[model samples]
Structures are given as C-alpha cells and as structure tokens.
Target: MKLVAKREGLLMMGFKGFTHFILVTDSQEAMMMLKSEMDWRSNVGNFVEDVRLLIIERTVTDVVFQPRSGNGIAHTLAQFGLMEGTHFFWEDVAPPWL
Candidate 1:
C-alpha cells in the first residue's frame, strides 16, 4: 500500500513539473532497500522497479532517510489533512497557505 501511494505521489510530482525528489523514510531497512539493486521475482520487487522507472523518467534526483523521531512538517501536514478530512491533489499550483 505504501508503494502504491508512493507511485501515485510520483505521478503528481511529475504532473507538477518536478524534476527532483528527495525521498524520506523512517526505517533503515527501507533505506537500504531503496539503495540496493532491484529484484524482478516478486511483487515487492516489481513495485521497486516501477518506482525506479518513475524516478528516472520524472528526473527524480535522490532518496534520503530520516529517523522516525523527527518532528517534521510532513507529519504536521498529514495530521492536518486527516483531522480536516481534506484530500487534495494540486493540479496547477500548491495551496497558497502551504
């Protein structure tokens, strides 16, 4: 489910003319997986491969990791979205308040 959401996010980024991406994750294992060679024999492998393609095609630049301890703005934005029951997809521009 996370991978699927990631793909969808890349799609939006691509649509927004984003040429670089800095990926964030909360797990060392996931960070390692993103850095390692992709596999072709499993569903997870396929998802990884797909993301790689998206990265290259969309000109995504890098993937980075942060420990779960960070009180980042992403967490706050996500919390606001959930509390407000607001699901938004920016097509032409990001919300002004953002």
Candidate 2:
C-alpha cells in the first residue's frame, strides 16, 4: 500500500490585548501532551521543547486547555482538516464558512 504523507502548518494571527491562549480539544491525551514539561530523551520531546520555547519567548503568555463539546466554528474547521488532508493557507479574508 502507498502511504500518503500529511503536512501540517501553523498560522499565527495578531490579536490585540490577548495575553493568554486557551486550546480547546476533544482529546484528553493531547491536553496532557501539551501540559507536560519538555522531555529531552525522546524524539517527540523536540516538539514539547518547541512548545516550551513559545511560552518562554512570551509568544503566548499562558496556555490552557478546554474540552470541546462538539460544537462551534472550530469544530467545522477541524472537520475540514480531517476531510481535506489539512494542507492549506489563507490570508486577509477567510472563506465564507469561516
């Protein structure tokens, strides 16, 4: 079977007067992953380090996790990612659904 590689990218938006970040997700495991301290022994640790760096640099003053209730526009965006293979970018104006 042929394997298809998935590429994911992060888009940073400028929000005025927002000092903290709250990430909402349905996965408790992901919440734990993000909340854990950076572990220097594993390959995934590098990703943890990146997250730590973001916090250290004050890119996000604070980070928290919230449980998603399968509602809202974010749920729609998540659905889009699942169906469309999660490779897209936009600037200025977003699509009408967003």
Candidate 3:
C-alpha cells in the first residue's frame, strides 16, 4: 500500500473513505491471509492485521491468485527485479524486451 500510495501520489489522508483495490499475488498463503482472519498471536499477525484493517477501512476490495504458469510476464518482471535490484514504473511504454 505504501508503494501504491507513492505511485498514485496519495497521502495517508487520501486513504480515508477510499475504495477500489485489486491485489494479485502468486502465493496461496497470501491469498489465504486476505481471505481469512489471522491469529493475533502469530508471528506475522501485525502484517495480517494491517491488511485486514485496509479491508475493513474499505481501501481494498478484491484479492486474486495467479498461478505461475498463468503469469509469465510477472514472473519475468520478478526475475528482472532480482537481477537489477530495482523496481519499474510503467506509464506510456514498457521496455522493449518486455
């Protein structure tokens, strides 16, 4: 959410009363975290609580899981991130290799 806020030029105040979020991940555990409540005593409970708060606060609407085979482009991007130690911001056109 912090990365998204930076990308979208949003401040903490901007989250108030905001809606319309779609989260896509390849991890089943991440999907489950979004779908169910987590035990407060668990090691990653704080992170889970934060995500749940976003949902309860109406900042996020949906979460989807994409299989590795179904998300080749994303897989490639992940590799790029690892290789270059950088992140990308797409606007008008993507890199030629992509």
The most accurate candidate by TM-score is: 1
lDDT string for model 1 (1-98, tens) is: 44554676778788778876676766566557667885657887777777777878887677777866784655555556667775557567755777
* Rank by TM-score (best first): 1, 3, 2
Q: After superposition, which runs of candidate 3 have C-alpha atoms over 4 Å from their true positions?
A: 1-19, 40-43, 53-58
**Poorest stretch of ten by lDDT in candidate 2:** 1-10
lDDT of 2 by residue, 32-94 (tens): 665676465776555555555544443554344445565565556656766887544455666
| Local accuracy by lDDT, each model | 0.68, 0.47, 0.59
Model 1, position 23, has a per-residue lDDT of 68
* Model 2: lDDT to the true structure: 0.47
- For TM-score, candidate 1 versus 2, the one ahead is 1
- lDDT digits (tens) for residues 4-75 of candidate 3: 322232223243444666656677776786677556576566666666665556555677788879988867
- Number of clashes recorded per candidate: 0, 0, 0
Order the candidates by lDDT, highest first.
1, 3, 2
